[model samples]
Target: MINHILDHRYELLEHIGGGGMADVYRAHDQLLDRYVAVKILHSQFSNDEEFIEKFRGEAQGAAKLSHPNIVNIYDVGKENNNHYIIMEYVAGQTLKDLIQSAGKLSVSESLRIALEIAEALEHAHANNLVHCDIKPHNILVTPTGRIKVTDFGIARAVTSSTMTYSGTIVGSVHYFSPEQAKGGAISAKSDIYSLGVVLYEMLTGQLPFTGETPISIALKHLQEEPVSVRKLNPTIPLIVEAIVLKAMEKDPNNRFANSTEMIRDIKRAESGLLHGDRQNNAISNQDPFATQILPRVSDSLPSRKSNLAPDEKIPQTNLLKSKKFLWGLVCILILGFFAGAFLSYGKFWSNAEVIVPDVVGKQMTIAKQMLETKNLRVNIAETYDADVPAGEVVSQYPAAGTTVKEQRLVTVYISKGGEALEMPDVHGLTKVAAETKLKNMGLKLGKVEEEYSNEAAGTVLNQTPRSGTKITKGSAVDLVISKGPKSRKVTLPDFSGSTLNSIETQLKSLNLKAGTVTEVTSSKPAGTILDQTPAAGTDIAEGSSVDFSIAKTEKATDKNTNKNSGKDASKDTNKDTAKNSKPADAPKDTK
Candidate 1:
C-alpha cells in the first residue's frame, strides 16, 4: 500500500496516527513541498460499499467546517480503491496519548486544552455541525501547546447515512451520551456530554465507566452517573465540577446549550467569578454557533431478513392470531413426536436407589472409571489449588455416594497448581513501581544493580526471577536498573611515528585499557602508529595502556591477515594503529 504512494504527488512518509476507522499518514506534498496529513479510510472499510460512501460523505461534510481551532481539510481523493482526505498536518500528539505519557496533567494545562477544544466545538456548532466524538483522542495539542479538534461533524454525518447501516455506535463507549447509547436523538449537547467525559479522563487519568465488554460499558454510560472530577483531583474548581456534572447529565436539556457557554463558564471559574444569568447572556451573545439541529435516532439492530417458513406468511391484521395457532400446533406435534420416540426406545422400570461412590482419595483417572461403571460421567473443571497437588481432583460438585439419575454428570474440580500470576507489566516503570508491584505480590527485592542503557536510568530491566517464572511469594528477586550510558576513563596515547606497541605502553602508564588494533597501508613505514587509543584528545587517568597497531608498508603483503583486517575494519575502523603514522600528520592514502 505504501509503495503505491512513493510515486504519488503526496508521498506518504510514515504513519503518524490511526483509529478504528482510518489511518493518518505524514505525507509530503510534492507540488508544494510541504507536509500534509493524509487520513485514509481503513482497508476494511474501503471495500465495504456502504462504509465507503459514508466515509467520503462525512469527509466532505467535515471539510466544509473551517475554523482556527479545527483541523483544516485540504483535499479528498481516491487512488484506485483507496479513499483518503488530505488535511493540514499539525505537529503534535493527541490529548489521549499525552495524558497517557504524562499521567494527570496540572489543572491549568488541562483547562487550557479543554478551553481550546470547547472553542473549536463552538465553531463547529455555529457551522451547524456537532462533533459527536469529542474525546481526548480526537483533540491534538501542538508542540506550541495550541489545541486543535479533528474529525468534525463526521460522526453524525456517518451515522445519518443509511449506507453505513444501523446499530453501529458512532462514538467511543466511554464517552458516549446517554441518548446515543439508547439509540435516541442526539444534538450539540451530546457533544458537550462527550466533552465532559474527556474532562473527567484528563483530570482522573481514567475513563468514567469501564467494563469487560463494550456493551456493558455503553450501558453504564446510558444509565450511570460518572464519578466527580473534583473527587479525583481536589484542585479542580467547584464551578468546573458543576459544568462537568451538568454536561454529563443523562438528560440532554441539562447540559450547556453550546460549547461557547461552557467556555465562558470555564473562564469565569478560572477568574474566581460567580457565573449568573448576565454571564450566560454575555456568553450567549459571543457564541458564534447557536443553531439547533436535532439528531436522528438510530435503531438498536441493523435491518436483517428473518428466515421464516412459507406457512408463516399472514395478513398484518391476522398476524398475531395466525402466529399463536401455528405455534400451538407445532408445539403439540413436537411433544407427540418426542413422546412416541421415548416410548419406542426406552424400557420402563421401577425406581431403584443407588449409592454414589466415594472417590475422594482415588486418582482422577481411576475415579472416572469407577463413575463410568455406575453410568455417570465426569465433568472436569480446572482451578488453582495452593494446597492440592496439581493434576489431582480437588473436590466434587456432588457429594459422593448419593443416589441420583443413572446418567447424571458428576462435576469435579481439578487442581492446576497455584494460581498463575501474570508478570506485572513493569517496562518503562519507575523504581517506586517495581517496589510497589513486588511488595503487593508478596515479593522482595534482593539486590539492585544500575547499569548504562538507552532506557530511563532508573527503569528496571533484568531481574533474577525473570517475569513469568513462578516463585513462592515473598521471594527476594534481584533487579537490574538502567543507569544511563556507560562512562570510562581512557588514557591518551601518543602516535608520533612510534611503534603501535610503544603507544600501547604509553597508554598503560595512564591507567587506561587497550582494545583491538588495526594496521593501515601507508608510506610512513612498516610499523608506525597512525592513531592511538582514547583518540589523542581524550582525558584519562594514569597507569592505563591501549592496544596499538602500526601502518604497514605498501610492499608488505599478508593476504590472510589483510583479509581478516578488512573484515575487522568493516566492523569497526576505530582500531589503534602503530606509532609514527599519527593520523593528525599522516598523509591521506592515495589509493
Candidate 2:
C-alpha cells in the first residue's frame, strides 16, 4: 500500500504510478535525505522466482547506465515480502499526457523530444541494454521541457516474462516491432523499431498501426506498411519521414543496426544534415526495386521455416561429396591452364598497356565493372566529399586515359557526405533573433535554460555554444535566460507617527516583515510607535523587517503626604483639590 514504507527506510508518500506488474510510489529515503520513486513488484509477481530474478537482473543492468536523459536507479530491496526499486523522483508529467493535451506538436518540438529519446537509447544500447519500451508513457517531460526516460531495463524484464508464455508480445501493441509481433528474439533493433513508432505518433498525432486486439495490432506491425507521415501532417519534413520508415522496416537488416545508428539518423534528419545522395526530396526516394522483390520473409510467420520441395532438399552426405569433387576439379583445371598460358602469354601480359577507365561520378558498382573491362582491378575506398553524392566515385587514383599494366589496381574513392561545419554562438539574443541566426548558419537551436537574474534580467545571458566557439553545423545551441533580480525594492512606510497596529498594517501592505516590538517610556500614548530603522524615506528591498518601539505612559506617581497632620497641611491639600476640581477638561499647567 502507498501508506506503507519499505524496510522503514523509504517513507511512502503518495501513489504516483502503477501497472499490472508493479506500482510506483513517491517516497522519501530518510537515509539519503532525498525524495525517491519506489517501484514495487505486484504481490502476484513477488512469489515467482523467475520474475524476481529477471526484475533483479534488469534493475542491476539499468543501474549501470549513467545518462542525464535516463532516470537513475538508486537502490533495490525487498521488505515484508514486497520487492521494490528506488529511483530518481522527477516532478513532471509523462510524454503521453503532454501529447494528448496538445493534440499535436510542432515539427521542431517533436524533433526535440525525438532527439532526447534517441540519445537515451544510444547510451543504453552502447551499454548492452535495450529499453524495449520506447513509448510516450515511459518518457517524462519536465516542467522545463527536459526529457527523462523511465522504465528502462524494466521493460526487458517484463518482456522476458511475456516471452516465456508463448503467443504474447512483451511491449505495448501500439509500439511493437515486426519481430516482436512474431514473438521472436528481442534485440537493439527492436528498441529502434519502437522509437520509430514513438516518432510517428509524435509527428502525426496518431499511431501508424492499430487494431481491435493486441494480436491484431501486432500483426499490422509485421505485415502492413504504415501510411506516409506527411499525409497526416503536411509540414512533416521529408527527411524525418524517411528516417522513421527506415527505422520501422519489417526486415531487421533494413532497420538501424542499433540505437546509436538510429540516433545518428535522427540527429541528422532533425538538423537537415542528410548525406548528399540522400538529399533532394528524401520522401520520394523509395526502396530499391531489388529490395521490393526480396523473397518472402519466413521469419514473420509463426512457422520460422519455409516449406521446401523434396528435390530441393539434398542428402547431407551426397551434398558434401559433390562439393568436394567440384572444388578438386576446379583446382586442377586452374593449375593446368595457368601453367600453359603463363609460359606463352606471361611476357606479353607484363608488357600489355591498359587505359585508365573514367569512373568518377558513377555509382560504385557501375564504376567497378567499367574498370574491370580494361583488365584493371578496382580498389574501392569511401570518403566524405561535399561536392559528390554518396555511393558515387568522387575521385580515382589513376586519372582518366592514363596507361597502366593489365590487371593493375585502380583506387577509387566514393563519396559519403559533406563535411560538417562548426556550430556558432547566438546567446543573449531574443527568440526571433536566435531563430534567424541559427537558420542562416545552418545550425539548430536546442532547449533554452531560463532563470531569474540580477543583471540582464528577463534576457538571454548565455548559450551552450559560447561566442567565438566552433561546432559542426546543425548542432544544438542551448540558451540561458535571466529570471530577473533575486529581490525587488519597496519604499518604507511612514510609521514614525502611527500606532503599532496601524504601522503593522502599513508594513504588511508594503510586503515588509515586522521585527520584535519593545515598549519604552515616551511622550506619546502607550500604543504609538517611536521611530524605525531605515528611515521612512529610505528605500529597502521588499520583505525587509522593520523594528519600532511603542510608548509606555508614565505610571502614576505613588507618594504619601501627611496632609491630615496639621491644619496648614490640610489647607494646602484643600487648595490642590480645589485646583484639580476646577474643571476636568482644563489643564493644570495652562491655568
Candidate 3:
C-alpha cells in the first residue's frame, strides 16, 4: 500500500506501526503541506459494512476531541478499497518504546508523564468519552517531553482477537480495569483504573498483571491486587503511590468518581499533600491476619428448650406469684444499682447514633436541613459539576446508611454548574495543536474553515470564542487555518530503468499515471521499458500525464528463414556425399 494516496490529500510515505486490524503509515498531506499519520482498516473487514460504519462513527467522535496531550484527528475518509483516518503525526517514539529501552524511569519523570496523561483523560471524560484501552503503546512522547495520548474512540471499535500474537490487544489486558475484564459496564472510573495500572508500570517498570495467556491476565485484572509500586521501587513518594492505588480500586464506587477527581488528587500528590492512609486501594495493603475475628454463631438456631426427663417432675407450685414477688425485689435492687452506676459513669450512654441519610443530588438547602435534623453537622464543599445542577449536592462522603455518632461531620460537595475555562491562545499553532488546546479546556471543535495565508498550511489563523473567552464546559469553538501558499506544481520522481510494476508504483506516489503506450525500436530486449513522454526529475502539476514505451525485438520469421536455409544446405551436402560413397557401400537406397 506504500505510495498510495487516499482522497488525493494524504500520500502514504512509510509504514509506521499498527494493530491486528489496521496499519498506520506516515504520510504527507499534499493540500495542507504537512505530514500526517494515516490509519487504514484491514481489508478483511472492508466487506462488513456494519463494522466499517461503526469504525467511521467512532473516528468521527474522536475527531471531535481536542487536547494538548491528544493526537488531533484531521480527517476520515475512504478511497477505493481503503478506509482511512488522517491524524497529526508526532515525531517521537511511543511510551512503550521508551519504557522498553529505559527499563524504568525515575519517579519524578514518571509522575510528570502520568500527570500529562491524566490531564488528557480528564478532558475526554468531561466530554463523556471513555478510552476502553489505555497502555503505553498508545501514548506518544514528543521530543520536548510532551505526552500525546492517542487512539481515543478507536479503542471501542477494536474487538479482542483470540489470536495470541495480537500483542496490541493482549498487551492491553494487563491494564484492563476489573469491569473491563468482566465485560461489564464501562465508564469514566474504568479509565481511571486503567490509568492507575499505567502509573504502576511507570513507577515499577513492570505490568501489574501478567500471564502466559490473555485470559489469565484478564482474570488477574478481575481478582488480583497488584504488587505495591513503592515496594518495587522505594523511591516513589508515599502520596504518589497512594494516588495510584486509590485510582486502581477494583470497585468503581471505591475508585475516583471521575477523571476530575483523579486529576485533583494527582495535583495534590505533586505537592506531597496526600497521605498514605487515604489510599482506597490500600485494602490490598491491609493484613487480613490483623483483622479482629469475631466468632460467628452457627447457622443452627438456639434450641427452644433443653431436653427434660419427664419422670423426674414431682410438684407444681404457684410459680407466677412467687416469680412476681422475686421480680419486684430484683427491680428495686436494679433501680438502686443504676442510680449508683450513672453517678460513676460520665456520658457513655448520652450520645445517640443515627444512620447517615443519602443526600446526594438533593438541593443543598434541603440536604443541609436533612443532615442537621439527623444531628449530623453538614460540611459543605462547593465545586463545579457538569452533570449535577448548581445548588444541588454533587456527592457526599461517608455515603448514606453508615452508622455514625451524633455531631459527626458529613462532608457534601455542592455543584456550581459547569467549570469556567478560558479559551487558550491557538493562533500561529498547528491545527492539531489548536484542537488539543480546545479539548483540554473541556470544549468541542466547531466547523473548521480554511484560508490561504503566507503562513504554512495547517496553522491556525483565527478562532471563534476568541482566546481568553470564558466559557462553560463542552462549548464549541470554530477555527480558521491556513491552507498554505498555493502551489500548483509538484516534484516528479526518478523512474529510470524500472519495470511496469515499479513505474506504476512511482506514478501513484507522484499522483501521476501513464497516459499512452507505444512501441519503440531499441537495442533492449522485447517487453523491456524504453522511454517516457516527460523526462524524469521534471516538475509538473499533479495529474499531468507521462507516456512511456517498450522495446520490440527482431521478427521471428527472419530467424526461422535463416535456420531453414542452413538445414537445406546441409541436406544437399549429405545427399551428394551419400551418392559419391555408394559404390564403396555396395548398396544404397535406390528410391
Candidate 4:
C-alpha cells in the first residue's frame, strides 16, 4: 500500500513495523505537511465491527493524554477496509533493539529510562487509560535519551476480546501480568506489572520468564517469581531490583498503588543513586522474596519451679529489714543522680550553636559546602523553577538565617530548570482551537499573521519554531492564519487566427474553460477560429469560460449530382434504342 493515501490526507510512505493486530506505516500528513506514523488494523480485526468501534473509542480516549514521554495520537479514521490511527512519528530505535544491541544497560541508564516510562504511565493512568501492554518493543528511545511510550489504548482494546483468537495473545506472554494471564480484571497495576517486566529486561538483557510456548510463559507469570535482577546482572543496584519485584508482584494489590507511586519510588531511588546514599539500599535490604513466619504465642505460662524456694523467699523479706543494705543502696542512688545530671548537661545544654547560612539563590554544591563548613548537615530537595537556573537553591529551611545547634540538618530546595515540553502540531486547526490548546498547555499566542491560501479562513497555515520543538512553558508561539483562496483576474490572451484546439489549450492554462464551440460556414480552414465572444484582450476572472465560433467547410449538395447522373442515363437509353432499331432492319436482310 505504498503511495496510497488514506482519507485523501495521509500518504503511506513505508512499512515500518507490525504486531498481532495492526501494521504500522510511516506516512506523511498531506494537510499539515508533516510526517506521522499510521497504524492500520489487520484485516481480521477490521472486519469485526465491534472490535473496530472499541478500537476507535480507545484510541480517541488515549489521544486526550498529552505528555512528552507518550506518543501523541493525532487522528483516527477508516478508509474502506482499513482502520488506521495517525500518531506522532518518533525517530529512533525501539528499547528492545537498544537492549539487544547493547546486551544490557547500566543501572543508571536503566533507571533513567524506567523512570521516564513510569512518568508516562502515570499520566496515562491519571486519565483512566491503561497501557495494558508495556514492553521494551513499545518503548521508543530517541537518540537524545528520551523515552516515548506508544500503543497506549491498543492493548486495552485487544484484551477486551478473547486473547486466544488465532491461537495467539495480543501482547507478549513473557511480560503479561498475573491478572492478565488469568483473564482477571485489569487495572493500572497491570501496566505497572508490564513495566516491571520491561525494566527487568532492560537491566538483565533477558525476559523475566520464557518458555517454549506462550501458555507456559504466561503460567510462569501467574505462578512463579522471577529470578532476582541482581543475580542476572550483578551491577544492578539492590533498590532497582526491589522496584522491579514490587511492580511485578503477582497480586495487583501487592504492586504499586498506581503509576504515580511507582514514579515516586523510582525518583527516590534515582536521587539516592545520584547522592551516593545508602538509604534506599537499607530499605531494599528487606527482601520481598524471602518468606517470613509469625512468632508463636503460648496460651498459658508454666508455673515456676525453684530449687531453693524457701531460702529465696526468706531473703526478700530480710533484704528490706537490713540496715547495712539500706545504707549501701542510698550511697549508690546519690552517685547515679550526679552522673545523670552531668550527662544531660553535656548532651543537650552544652552543645555549641551556629547560625544557619543564607543558601537561597546559591549553587547546590556551594551551599552544601558552606553549610558543612559550620559543622551542619545538608539535606537536598529538588523542584522545577521557571526563573531560577538548575542546581541552584530556591529556598532553605529555618528561613536560611536561624540559629541552631551544631550538626543540624538543613533542607535546601534546588531548581530543576524550567518545565519544558514538545510543541504540539497546530497546523490546520481553527484560530479558536489553536488558542485554546496553547492556553491549556501553558503557552501563549504571540503574533497571528493572515495570508491568502487554499485553506479555509482562520485556519493555521504555519507556526514558528514548528511542531516537536522543545519549548518551555509560557513561551510564545507565532502563527500564520489562512485567509482562504485568492480571487485573481486574468487578461484574456489574443485568440484571433488561432485554431480552436490552441484557443482551448490557452484557456485551460489560464485557469479558464471552453464555454461553447459554434461552427459557422466561412472561407477558412476547418476548425479555425472565426470569431470570439468578449473579444481578445478582455480582462476576466480566473476559471471563467470563453465561447468560440470556428470555421466549417460545407459539403456540396447531393441533389444536383443525382439529377446529372439521371440525365446521362436517359441519353444512353435513347441512343441504344435508335441503334438497335436500325441494326434490326439490316441484320434481318443479311440473314
C-alpha lDDT score of every prediction, in listed order = 0.71, 0.77, 0.77, 0.82
Write the residue-wise lDDT of candidate 1 on 1-591 in tens digits: 453463369888888878777788898899999998888876765666766676667677778887788999888888876778899999978898899998888766767777888888888788777777888888888898888898764567555542125334545778878777655567889889898888888877978899644545765776677777878888776656777787788888878878888897677655443454455445445654431122355554443334566567744577556888889889999988866654432222425434568776454445566676776656655666556755456788568867765556677765654555545545567777888988898677688888889887899877777777766554677888899766566535466588756555555555565666788878787788777665666676544455566687664467678988889986565444443347676688899
Q: lDDT by residue for model 2 over 1-591, one digit each (tens)?
A: 666768978899999988876889999888988999999888877787897898898889999889999999988888878888999999989999998998888777887898899899889888889888889999999999999999987888887886674334446879878776655678988888888888888888899997534544655776679999999988776667778888889998998777766666666565453343244334224423211212367645664124666457644577556988899889999988876665423323588887888889976556766887787766666666656755577899878998877766788887754545655555566766877888787677788777877656647778876777655555667888777777779877678767877656667878888887788888787778888777788889888888877787654432123433566777889999998888767656755
Per-model root-mean-square deviation over C-alphas:
29.2, 31.5, 29.8, 30.4
Please identify which of the two predictions, 1 or 4, would achieve the higher lDDT against the true structure: 4
Candidate 4 structure quality by residue, lDDT tens digits, 275-346: 764554544456443222223455344445445565565334587778989999999999788666544222
lDDT of 1: 0.71
| Candidate whose TM-score is highest | 4
lDDT of candidate 2?
Answer: 0.77
lDDT: which candidate is best? 4
Considering summed lDDT, which 10 consecutive residues are worst modelled in model 4?
Answer: 287-296
User: Backbone clashes per model, in order?
Assistant: 33, 11, 2, 0
Residue 240 miss distance in model 4 (angstroms): 1.4
RMSD of candidate 2 to the truth, in angstroms, is: 31.5
Q: Is candidate 1 or 3 superior in lDDT?
A: 3
2 or 4, which is superior by TM-score?
Answer: 4
Q: 94 in model 3: Cα distance from truth in Å?
A: 0.7
Model 3: CA > 4 A from native: 159-171, 273-591
